[model samples]
Target chain A: MSTWSMALRQSDYYWTLYRRTWKGSVFSSFLTPLLYVLAMGVLLGGFVEADPSRLEGAPSYLAFVAPGLLAAQTMQTAVFETTYPVLSATKWQRVYFGMNATPLRALDIANAALGFVLLRLVLIAIVFVAVLAPFGVFVSVPAAIGALLVSILVGAAIGMPVYAYAVGVPNESSFSLIFRLGVIPQFLFSGAFFPISNLSPALEWLARLTPLYQGVDLTRMLSLGTWHTGPALVHLAYLLVLLVVFHRVAVRRLAKRLAF
Target chain B: MISARGLRKSFQQKGQEPFEAVRGIDVEVRRGEAFGFLGPNGAGKSSTMRMIAAVSPVSGGSLRILGLDPATDGSQIRGRIGVCPQEDSLDTELTVAENLYVYGRYFGIGRAEVRRRAAAQLEFVQLTERGGAKVEDLSGGMKRRLTIARSMINDPEMVLLDEPTTGLDPQARHVLWDRLFRLKQQGVTLVITTHYMDEAEQLCDRLVVMDKGLIVAEGSPASLIAEYSTREVAEVRFGIGENESSAGAVESAVGRRAERVEVLPDRLLIYAADGEAAVAAVHDAGLQPVATLVRRSSLEDVFLRLTGRTLVD
Candidate 1:
């Protein structure tokens, strides 16, 4: 079968599974980040009001964190969705055995899984953007849509490698380590919650190398309409490179793992 | 057609010896025939099945399915082969009909065609009434039938079933057998493995009895029984004490009447051409047993004779 057909089929399969079995988790997954934005930006920032810097132009703190939160939430959801679920379908539940028994190849299954993650990222981003509109965070409708697409691409770029790692390893400990050493570090040091310029030079260099930093930087640029061509190109290049490299790895690993 | 020559597979264990699961065996399955691999657990039946299914790589051998090398044309070969794995791997999140519909899509079937096939397959498995029910709510038998129906979504040329009736009740097993029989009648080649001697006797046109990664015997059920065991068997039991040492006496007493004598912990089995005459002779010899039964030889006898152990062991 053609790759597109297989990918579309697998995406539908995952969507059906998620809608029926994971409906309860979807609301909480999309709601938690919105609450975080409101509590951290409006509630917390109101009590600690300080003179607004020039970089922090017209929008309030809530608007500033809104796009970054959307990107971060998408990354979080996409990474977990692709990694554990992919591993479980292969090793734990062994659902791919049935799928691969048909015309679907391993690469088809991988693409389908990635497609599903992308779709979920977009859905979550739309919810985040809709919630932010009431808080006066959404600047331009077109820019908000562009930011949402960028969030999905960035999340997928980061998640595909983790998906590859999850399928290759035989146990769950490696995923735990990735969450502890990889994801936690990215979440804390990637300038999602605070400005990176205030950090030490060594920390900034480390943060700049992370996928989350590039993603948040791009989101911040889109949200503030402060799109400098050079930084935008650099962030786009980083995400593109990651997407190509990790997608190749995921396809190869899945082929070796699922196909004989 | 499926063919394999010098097929071998070995698994390396950490800090211990490497276990050879399949050891240089040859096999061929022709079109429109019911072939079976009959063996006890850990006899490499599953390893062989996996190799044939093209989901597990061959360590040192040549294998082909439908005139294609699994290593190169795995997807193409799999496209025409249905596989019912030992475990029921149905998507528990989906409804009965949705499970079939989505699995058909995996074969690149169109949505309209998948819907039509799903309906027909669900009806074939007698699950049409409960098509909308979630998978987790189905009984084990229903789940197994659904898995079988899911495998046929592509209308494959061959169907591979690994221990299809391993954990089903008698009625459920019979229902599955009936469905498989109908498929065989429609000229679909079937490959199956099971430890149940009765299942093999009922379904297999030809079978290989495997033990410890090797084939010990290969033939039809009737032929294997005729070759390995007598036509009839007699079981004689005495209510001796737990610590009794009368096994030797019983063996000596029935030795002349039967072709062979098997002494168990609680009884003695006498293999003979005519079980009724043998039991009468035992009575004539004044060996008053607590219980006695005469029956025809079964595939279980063939298995025991070849492997030197019970099939369930």
Candidate 2:
């Protein structure tokens, strides 16, 4: 088989295992988006005043935060998928070693794992979009599709680096630190909850430097049908570049770590 | 099927001197033979096995598997051989059958073919009934059988088993051995590494005894015994620490019949062509012993004679 097909076949292992647990994941994949749309958008959004100018032409707070929540959720999913699971496969369960004993190389294992993560990101994006669609959160069909694609890109950008880190860490103790200092901070301060312009100027600049903020901004613009060509390209470029660089780095790290 | 010359492996941790695991050992395993590497822990057996399995890189020296250089064609080499590592690398989350199916898929086997082989292998390992059970739910022996079953999922030409029965009970080991013996009968080349001498005797056609990262002796089981040890051994125990002081008497008592007397803290092992005659000589010399027994010599004696230490220790 070609290397690409071999990698795809390797990913089927994860797919087989995932089939046993996807039912239990309904809480995060389906209900989390529904809860966020209802509790945060419908209920909490009523208390906040909608300012189309400041909200970048969004009709209401619900429309504004829906895509941002989707982007944040994607980041969270990507981080969750990459951290403990990658470590467990590399160390505890040694699934990668088992595959390496076969015709699959380290590159194939990395590609297989990353491909599985991307498959999950796409499924979660679909659920998030479908869940919020009836609430009229998106302005157009193209906007919904655009936000979905951008969310998956954002997930890849965040997840690939986390995978590299996961492969290098000696144990799970560092995972809590990553969640506390890295993932949690990005979730709270990366323009997912409010406009970065609303934060202090320094904090806003720092937030803009984060990949999630770029995703959130692009997703929100796409959802509200207010994105411009130049700024959208810039955000897409940042996310695309981050995704490619970290993906290559993750593949290299897996190869190095599995080289024992 | 496998060849190596001056094969070496070293590990270099940061800020520490490099530690050589396999120190320049030459080995050859022909096709259709059950070969073994017999050694204690840290004897470089696993390291050598990894190189042959095409997983670990050779630190230095030349090695080849199925005539392919691992440095350039590792995946190709791996495609033709199966490896059961010392540690259990089986996926705990997967079911028994699922593990086989997934591992077969890694070899790029078609889904239908994987399913067919998975069932056949499960039956081969006598785990057909446990196919749907989670891997963690099985006992250690069952898990090991499942691992062996998964190793055969790709229908590999050769199988490398590192300590295949290390933690198994005697019955479990026997069951596993029966399965492995069946594989050998089917013409699959088997290369095993083990600390247990009986396992080597039971399964291997020929073996190399390793110690301190070096091959100390190499031959068939009986040949090595003939070369390094006598036909039999007489064990005489004078009770506890008394055996140490009684070594001189025991050695002098048996005389020429006792080719050598290995004194331990609790007993004296008198090597002889006739173990009962050696024990009778000890009695005739009026050296009173608490207990006595005679048995044929084995690979253990050969290793002890070569390394001057026990294999398991």
Provide i-RMS per model in Å. 2.0, 0.9
- Which lDDT tens digits does candidate 1 get at residues B1-313? 8898989988878999988999888888999999999999999999888878877788888999999998888778887899999987787767999899888877778889999999999999999999999998999999999999998888999999999988899999999999999999999999999999999999999999998998899899999999999999998887866213555665566666678877666777788998988888778778778899999998888887776688998
Candidate 2 C-alpha lDDT tens digits along B205-228: 999999888999999998999999
Candidate 2: segments with Cα more than 4 A from true spot: none
Best by DockQ: 2
**Which pairs clash in model 1?**
none
- Give me the TM-scores of chain B across the candidates: 0.96, 0.98
CAPRI-style docking class of model 1 based on DockQ: medium
Please name the candidate that would achieve the greatest lDDT relative to the true structure: 2
Model 2 C-alpha lDDT per residue in residues A1-260, reported as the tens digit of each score: 56688788876688887898898987778989999999989999999896787776778888888988999999999999999999889889999889888989877888888888998999999999999999998988998999899899989888988898898788999899989988899898887777778899999899999989999989988888888989889999998888888877887788777777
Clashing pairs in 2: none
Compute fnat per model: 0.66, 0.89
RMSD of each: 2.8, 1.7
lDDT of 2 at B151: 84
